[model samples]
Each structure stands twice: as structure tokens, then as C-alpha cells.
Target chain A: MMKDEELVIEARDLTKVFLDFWGRPKVRAVNGIHLDVRRGEIFGLLGPNGSGKSTTIKMILGLLHPTSGQLSVLGQSPRAVSVKSRMGFMPEESYLYKYLTADEILNFYANLYGMTGSAKTERVNALIEQVGLSQARDRRVGEFSKGMARRIGLAQALLNDPDLILLDEPTSGLDPIACREVKDLLLALARQGKTILICSHHLADMQDICSRVAILLQGEVCATGSVQELLSTPDTLKLTLQAPSQTTLMAVLDLLERETGTRPQVDLTGRTLESVYIETVSKRKSAS
Target chain B: MSHYFGKSLTRISALAGLTVRDAARSRLLVSLGGILIIGLIGLPLLISGDNTLTRRLQVILNYTLSFAVTMLSIVTLWTACGGVSSEIQDRRLYLVLTKPVHRYELWLGKWLGIVALNALLLTLTGFIIGIMIWHTLFTSPESETGKRQACEQFLLARQSRLPESPISEKQAQASAAALVKSGRAPAGIDAAQVATELMKELKNARFVIAPTGTVHFTTLITTPLSGINDGLLNYKIESSRPERSPIPALWEIQAAGKKAIHLSVTNYPGLPNRLLIPGAVMKNAPSLTLSYHRLDSSSSATLFMAQNGQEPELLIPSGSWAMNLGRGLLMILCRLAFLSALGLTAGCLLSTPVAVFAAFFIMVLLAMSGYVESVATSGAFYIPHEGHELSKTWLDKVILSQFKGLNRLTQPLLRLDPVPLLEEGRRISWLLTTQAVAWLVGLYTAVTALIGMILFNRRELG
Candidate 1:
């Protein structure tokens, strides 16, 4: 368990009930739920559609008021202006001014963060290059492709160098290479002691980066723990070895059956389609 | 505190800048510019007016300037309605609200952006109109005297003084009561209603002079006439008869410390007349009394001076025309500022189309407030014919009360419209301009902004 001071996000009985025009309860989007995200760790909020993941994230970001709850972000109320200044949020969609260029958009956000002069320019430039949007920096976001717009959105979320970053569907429309880059970026940010809370449907990406995750079903948490603790099967034994001939494989299987009183299942470890696609694209670019 | 204010200002300015850029890059600015260009330049060319230089100038000022202001007002309301509501509808506000910006700052930033755009457009169009006015004055085919007449009558910023009525409302009411008791008025009619109608008749009776009869008017000039060589007495007369022929009349003019001057002249009916009063005669005068005497007993026509106090008035040169035009434009800009705030407030509570409709409804109601006041004051929706009793109903009373309330609320906006004054070349006094700013921008706009900010802060952007 993390100490109280080390907890970046703490919630108790967080609930959001959407109301109709007459102020009657229409939908219970988020039920009484509790969450705790510690410092320097990537926490994932996994849920299917209408399962309150987005609502929870929105409440944490102070975008929506909880019906009845105690929630604190970075040891302060989420709606506090100072707290917001110390945090960053990337919504599910880009939600940018369509007419503004990427450079202009970043500068606008930087200004909102009270940055100015040469430092603002330098940071904006570096982020543009980091997002691989240097060539498209002058183009308006309205003209950008979905993947390119997503990259710009990510860059803006990191513009303030916030201590706690909340991203919703960070890699929804990204290509495999961009997805890998984003995952790598999240790891690097965690290494630098920045807390991240992500809400996404991509379980593979969540499993790859999240130290701990909570699975929500119909506005309530169904399961939560570390990836290893939740995924490990206590009765199963797994091992990997170098490539072996068919006779060698059969000898190994027979020895396992003799030792364990059952024949062990065997399978080949294969590369993920995402990794293969990235490798192929990289190799093709190199050859060109 | 100063540092905090500085940072807040910086954020607001960035948001404001974004709004301006959005307008510039979108089709709004271009469309407005195109409309203004065509209206300002094409309108004067298309409309036909009298060949007199003064008449033509009046037409240009009245039509083209009015057109520009009307177009700008509609566009300003539309743009302001869409500016914030569209962003909210499209969910762009999600990203903005997540930042450290106070909701008030965001609301104020949008208002300032729309106001700034209006200022730019007003200034540009005003400049173009000024150039056109001057170009017409110098290049018209009229003679030099005609041009000089136009400059004096239509181009100079003059102050008008109307004669004060000698009769009071109390006197009218007492007389109305006597008539009602005497059964001369319709039964069941209120004395107050009778008094209002009686007052109009009494005032109108003062301007009508039977043949061989005389009528007098006294005008007090508050501002001293200095350096001006002449002042004008502008009047229009109509006869009870339909004859368009001229009638012979004698005018007796009296000023302080000066002898009464009398002149006999033939005045045409249904035409405007200007009588020049020398500066020497009016140099130190505090007031002037003029008496009109019908000279012909054989003529049976009863001369009726146009009432409403505007006719039979004195015009004294007060300021330069250019300065007056500038003040007029400033007043228009103040109105635009108020409209922007109103539109923003509506947008805060409604979607774009509904907001636009609500704002426009409000503007139209304000514009028609004069008629509303009349109807409310009369306590009837339609004018009752003479000798007709005004029947009362509870619903009528309730509706009239509502109309009165609306009129009271909107009276300040209509009290000092600059367009008519500009058309008549009357001075839009600095005091009037200051009051406009205070009432429209400071009072109305600030109130609307406060309501809008409160709503915006409480609104959920999720």
C-alpha cells in the first residue's frame, strides 16, 4: 500500500447521476466507486461502453461534478485552478480549434499555462518535433488527418509538463508505429516520476504499460490488481526455450508427462501483429 | 495581486486572440466586408433622390449609414450568438474548460473579441461614408450657392430649440374632468384618458390660426450664439384647404434688448421654409418670440403649423459636422456592444439558432418600444374612435401592465438614438454620448455579462 502523501489520486464513493431537464435522475453513469492512483505509476481505467470509465475520468479532471463523493487530485480539490494548472487532460477527441495551426494551438495552451517569450517557443518547437509533426506544424488542425490530429492532441496535453496527466483513449486512431511510440513515451514519463491515469478500451496496450488497473462493469468495479497478480494462473507452469527439433520436443513433452503425470501443452511464441507491422514499415523506410 | 491579474489577462488575451483568428479565417469577416462594400457604395448609386445637393446628401446619410448600421447589427448578433454556443455544441469547450481559465475570463474574452471586430468594421465603413459625403459635396453639379446652402442646412451640426407648451397636464386634466362631468365626453371613460387626448388637441389647437388671426411661439436658446453670422427658423405649414397656393403672412420677431422686427412675405403651403436671423439680432438674446399674422381676410384657408415641436424651431450652429458624425458612429458602436452582450447571454442559456431568435426578438421589441409605450399609456390595444367608450377588462389591464414594464426597461436604449440626429445634422452632444455609454454599455452590457458568466461557470461541459 502507498502512503497517503504518495497517492496522486484518491476517491471515495464517487458517483455521477445524469439528470433530465426536470432535474430528475435519468441515468446513473457512475455508481459509488473508489480509486487510488499512486505517484509515478500508470493506472488504467478499463471498461466497455457506458461502463462509467469516461465519467470517472471526467470527474477526476473536474469536468463533471460528482453527485456525492470525496475526490482529491494531487492532494487538492480537482476543481481548484491551481490544481488544474498542475495537471493536464487529453479528452477522447482532439477538441481543438479547427482553424488554428498546430503551432498556434500549442502556443495558445502554453499561454494558458502562463508561459511566454523564448521558453514557450522552444518548448513548442521541441514538442512539435517530438510528435513528428515538424513538417505539418504550419498546417491547420482542420486539414490534419485523424492520426496527425491525435499526435497534436497528445503534444498539447504534455505542453505544461504537468505532474499528473489524464488521457482518454490516447491511442484510439494511431498507427502501430505511433502506438509504439506513445507507449514508449508513457513509460518514459512514468520513469520521470509523473503520474498518468488512462481510460482506454485497448486492453493489450493497457496490459503492456499499466502497473495496476481496475475493470469496471456497469458503473462498478468488477476486478482490480496488478497485471501480474491478476493474470497469473497458480496451477499453470509456463516455459520458453530455443527452437528444437520435432524429436527433441516430443522427448521434452514425454519427460514433463512422466514428472507431472500429464502431457504439457506446447506452442510457439510468435511476434504480435503490431510489432511485425512496425518492423516491416521501418525496414521498408530504411531500404527506400 | 498584480501578478495574478497579469497572468489572468494573458490567458484572456490568448482566448480573445483565438476568437479573432477564428472569425478572420472563417467566412464571417469576408461576408461582412463584402456586404458593407456593396451596401455603402452600391446603395447610393442605386437610389434616386432630389437634384438639390442638400437633398442628395440627406438621402446618402440617411439611407447608406442606416443600411451599414443595420447590416452590422444583424451580423454582430449572429456572430456573437454562434461564437460561444457553437463551441459548446461542438464540444470544443471541453479542452478549454480543462485549462486554468476562469469561466468569466472566457465569457469576457469572447465579448471583447466581437466588440473589437465591430469597432474595426464601424471605423472602416464610417471612413468610407465620410469620403463619399465630401466627394458628393464638392463634385455635384449644383451651383456654389446651392452647395453653400447644403453645407449650412444639412452639413453643419446645429442645435435645435423647440417652444415650450404653455399648457400643463394639470390644466388639461381639470378641463377634461369638467367636460366629462358635463357629459361632453363618452360615458364610462376615465378622466386620465380624456386628459391625454385633450392635451393633444389643445397643443394642436395652438398651432392652428384662423384667417386674420395671430399665433405666437417662444424659443429659449440655452447656448449662446457666437461667431455664427446667421441662425435659421425652419418651419412647415399646411392649410385646412387642399390648395397648394401661397398665403400672405406677417412675422413679428422679438429678442432681448432688441426692437421687434416685422416682415411681410408670401409663404407656400406644404413646403419647408427657412428664415435667416442675423447674428447681430441674436447675439446676446436669451430667448426669441415670433408671432405669425395672417394678412389676407379674403383668404378662407386656416393655416396649421406642423405640431410635434420639431417644426417651427430654431437651429443654431453648435459644432463641426465631422465631429458630430464621429460621435454618431460612437453611439452606434455602443449599441453594438450592448447587442453583443445580449447575444452572448442568450447563447449561454440556449443553442445558437434559439439564441439568435431570442436576441432578435429582444432587439425588435426594443425598437418598437415607442409604439408599446403609446398603447400601454392609452390603456387600449387599438385607438378608439371619437365618442367611443373605452371598455376595460382584467386581461387588458394585465397585458398593458406587462407592456409598460417592458417599455420602462427598454426606454433608456431608445431615448437617444443618433441616426435621426445625424440625418437632421443636429449635434450628438458629448453628454448624450456619455449617457449612451453609461446606459447601454456600462449598465445593460455589464448586467448581461454578469448573468452570462454565472450561467457559464455553472454549465457542465462534459
Candidate 2:
């Protein structure tokens, strides 16, 4: 477990109230929320529609001003330009310059961060290749497919190699293969000691990746805990074993049923379909 | 300071490059260029010069060039407006602002990109017109004499010298006092009204010549007239006699410390006539003195040489035509830069269509700035008929007064206009170009960029 002292993000009573045209109170998008994200942690913000997940993420990214609260990323105000340089944000949509090619889009962002010369070109090419868009690098973004555009967006978010990467619905339009790639990429980045804040509704995906999470409801945190603490069934015992003979499995189930005075539910033990699919496709790719 | 500037410059350069790429790829740019090319090249094919190749060239330069400038300005404003407004609307601005770019950098970068594009387009069209004009001049069937005359008078940048400055307020006041004392003005007449009336009258007043008498006037020559002989003197002669007829006269021109020129005026109709003087006698003269003798002893006459009123002028070559054209275009570019800044500021504050409409509205107002000036200075919206005073209502007074204030605010921005000078083949003086650069491109652009940056920085992007 990472130490709690190295906090990369801190919020105290953080709130954001969206106003009407007249600037009167219209809706409370985030209400008095507190959060602490440590360095090298994969933190997830999970919620349903209108539950303030995206709004909270936007506030954290300094896109929206809080009504009343203190929020900081990298020990500085989110609005700080230098702080922004060290951070990256992938918004809910792929808001890229449609007229520019993928290569240009990455290069543009890199240059905005004051990167230039061969270093910029090399980084841009590497990003394009990493996002698996090397083939379509020259195609205009407007001509790219939704999945391809999402991939490019991810690549741009990583262009500066930011320490604090914020991804909002990062896997929304990605294919399963791309989704796995993104999840693995997040893990790899976390291993490299980068702080990641992901706002999404994919519970299974979040469970597979997030070390800690906060569930929001009606602009408030309904629950907050580590993945194990939140999802683990303390009252139940689980066993994982290789598939045995049918008789052996039946005897084990009978013993459990007799002890509990109830029927035991049995299920097949196998790899997840996603894992199997990835394995099959990768094997085929390697053979080709 | 240098380090920060260098960093800001780098970011601004990147954003400007991106903006240029976007503009180049836009279909609107291509469409505008197509229209501009058609208007520039195709219009000459459609219009006949009426007779003379000089007239044809004049029409092309006057109409086609003006049309091209207007079109380019409109397109430049449109591109500038769309460059910022469309980015905000499409949410692409979100991506950009999230980077480490300052709002000022973004604003300046957009302006620079639009300006760069305008320069390219203007240079291209200007080159085409220049080439076309030279080709037409070389290929025309006019004799060498006609060609040389046209080249000397129409194709060169000339400076105009008047007899004197216009009648000042003090002169007008003196005239008003004479009129009041002479019992011409009614008792208790409005003194301000009388002064204005006298000013207008003095502006159009004629120089009177008694029968068989001589009238002398001296003019300070500012430009050099060193070439072969030719001068145009515009005059209107009116005879005070029972039988209306042309008056004959002897024209004597005495240059400072030079041999005097004597020519006989044979025809002087009631309508204005242009007298062509022979010999380059006015050359190397610091000033010129004209003596008009009324040789027609039977009739008295009046001569009019009003300033800017079809007055007699001595046009002297001052500079090269090509350099003058370049200066004129540079002035146009300055105005375009100001317009681009205004469009960008509006775009930052409003949506695309609204910003475009506002910019166009401002352009129209600037084009009609003469009316603004009149209303502001005279407190009258429109000039009255000859010898009549305007009856202004309170509403007219209030509205015109307000417009007067606005005119005072925007006068500096609207003052320099190069089109007329270009049409007349007059030198666009360096002073005027300097004023344009100072106000239009420097002060005005900076203010506009500041306002845009403030608005954009305060804007909430989602």
C-alpha cells in the first residue's frame, strides 16, 4: 500500500454550483465533497447519470470553479498554469481540431507545452504509434472513426507525459481490445508513479483497475473505500481451484450444503471472456 | 523578460501555425479566393474602356482594385471571427485552453494568422493587377506622345499644391463681422449661424477681375516639376454683361527667379475649362505667381480656384508609381488588421453570426464617417439646400449630438483612407501611413486584443 503522506490531490468541502444565465443558483453539481488522492494511485469516481461524476472531475481539472471550497492538484491550485503543464485531462468528448491529422493534433498539444524541435516530433510519432494510430496518422481527425478518435484523444492526453492524468469516460467509445489496452496502460502508468483520476460508470472495469474509489449520488459521495473494502463479502468464503472430476466437485458441494443446510451454487471456473478474447486475438496477431 | 517573451513567442507561434492550417483547409477560404480572382481578372473582360486604353485601365484600377480590397477585408474579418468563435462552439477551445497557453497568446496568434493569410492573398492579387496594368500599357495602340502623357500624368505619383490653406474660423468671423456691420445680417441675428454661413460662402467664393484689370495670386510649390512641359489649370469664367459670352484673357506665369511664361487664353466658356500650359517653365521654382489680365475690356469676370472644388491645380511628380502603390496597399493592410482585431474581439464575446454582423455594421459606419463628421461638427445631420438653414428638431439634435460624441471617439480610426489617393495616382504620404500604423495596427489592435483576452479568459469552457 502506498503511504498517505504523499497526497497528489486534496480537496476540503469542495463544491460547485452551476448557475443560470442570470448567475443565480440553478443546480448544485457538487456539494461539499472531500477527497484525497495519493501519488501512484488509480482513483475511480463512479456514478450514474446526473450524479455529478463528470462535474466533480471537471472541478478537479479546474474547468469549473467551485462555489465554496479548497481544491488543489499537485499541491497547487488547479488553475495554476504550471500545475496544468504537469497535468493532462481527457474530457468526456474528443474535442480535437477536426481539420488536423492525428500527427498534427499531438504535435500541437506538445508545442503548447513548449516542446519543440526533434524532441517534439519524436514524442509525437511515439505517441501515435503507442495509441496504435500510426497507420491513420495522416488521416484528418474528422475522417476518423469514433473509436479511432477516442484513441487519439488518449494519445493527446499523454503527450506531455503528465503526472496527474484525468480521464473522463476514457473507454466510452473504444473497442474491447482498445479498452484492455487503456486499462493496461493505466496500470503501467500507475507503476511508473503517476496519479490517475478516472470518472466512469463501468463498475467491472473500475473494480478490475481502481485501488480506491468514491461512489457519488446526487452531487455527494455515497461511499468511499478501497476496492477490496467496498466489494469484499466478509460473511462469505470463496474458493478457486482447477476444475476436478465431476464426482469430486459434487462431493465438495454436498459437504458445503450439509454444513450450511442449503443447496450450494456451483459455476464453471474459467478465464473471463475478455481475457480469453484478448488471448485468442493476440495469438492470432502473433502468428500473422 | 527575454526568457518569458521567448517562451510566449514559441507558444503563440504554434497556435498561429495551427490557425493557419485550419484556415487553409477551410472551404470558405477557397470560395473567397475564387470570387476574388473572378472579380479581379474577369471584370476587365466584361467592361469596355468606353474608348481609350487609359480609361479602361483607370476603370480596372478604380473599380476592380477597390472591389478586391473590399472583398479581401470582408474575408479577413470573416476568417478571424470564425477562427475563434467556431473553436469555442465546437468545444475545440477546451482542448487548447487546457494546455499551458495564455489567453493573450491565443488571441495574438489568431490575429497573426489572419494577418498572414491576408498578406499572402493581397500580394497575389496586387501582383496580378500590377502585371496586367503594365501589359495593357505596353500593348495599347496609343501614340508615343499619348503614352508618355498618360505615363507622366496618370501612372506617376503626383503632389498637389494649392494657393493657400482654407478659410479659418477667424477669417470666417471677420467676414461675419463685415456682413453684420454692412447691414446685410438682420438685427439680433445668431452670430454662430452667421459665422458658419460666412465660412461656407468663403469656401466657394470666386476671385473677381475688374474690366481690363490684372489679378495676381501666388502659390507655394511643394513638389518638384523637373520634367518636360505640361500643366493643367482648371478655371470657370463668368462674364458680367448684358450678353453672356466667353471672356478672353492673357495668362502670365512667373516662376521664382525664372523666365516668365506668357500664353493667350482664347476660350473661357461659362462652364469650367481646363487650360493646358506649354513648356516646363515651372521647373526648379520654389513658388509660382500667376497674373491674369482681363484683355476683354467690355466685360468684368470672376475666376474660381476653390480648394478641392475642381480648383486649378499644378500636379507635380513626387515619387515612383510602384512604391506609391505599395504604400497604399500597406495602408489597406493596416485597416484590415484593425478590422481583424475587431472581429476577433467580437467573436470572443459573442457567437459567430452576431460577431460577423457587428463587424460588418462597424465597417458600414466607418465608410459613412463623413456624415458622422458633419453631424458632429455642424450639429446638423444633413446639409440644407443652397442658402437655406436647417431646421433641426430636439430629437435630431439629441441623436446627432450623441453621434457626434461617437464620431469624436472613432475619428482617429476612420481618418486615413488610401483608395481615393490611389485612384488619383497621388502619393500616399509617409506621415499618413505612419498614423495608420500607430492607430490601426498598434493602438487599436492592442486594445482589441486585450479586450478579447479578458473576455476569453473569463469565459467558462465546458
Off by over 4 Å in 1: A1-5, A258-262, A283-288, B164-206, B227-230, B238-286, B295-297, B382-389
Clashing residue pairs found in predicted model 2? none
Q: List model 1 lDDT by residue over B1-462, tens digit each.
A: 988998899898888887778888997888888889888878887774655676778778889888988898999899889988998899888788788888898888888899888998998888888888898888899889777767777777888888766678889889999999899999789899999988888778888889999999888988777735467788888898898887888888888778998877788888888876655667768988889998879888888898765469888788888999899999999999999999988888899999999999998998897888787777658444478676655677788889899888878877868888898778899999999999989998999999999987787756
DockQ of each: 0.74, 0.66
User: What's the lDDT for residue B418 in model 2?
Assistant: 82
Clash count per candidate = 0, 0
Residue A11 of model 1 has an lDDT of 89
Instruction: Write model 2 residue lDDT over B247-318, tens digit each, in one string.
Output: 778889888888888888865546666555543766777778877777777554544433445556655567
Report the TM-score of the second chain of model 1 against its true counterpart: 0.85
Candidate 2 docking category?
medium
Q: How well is candidate 2 docked (DockQ)?
A: 0.66
Clashing pairs in 1: none
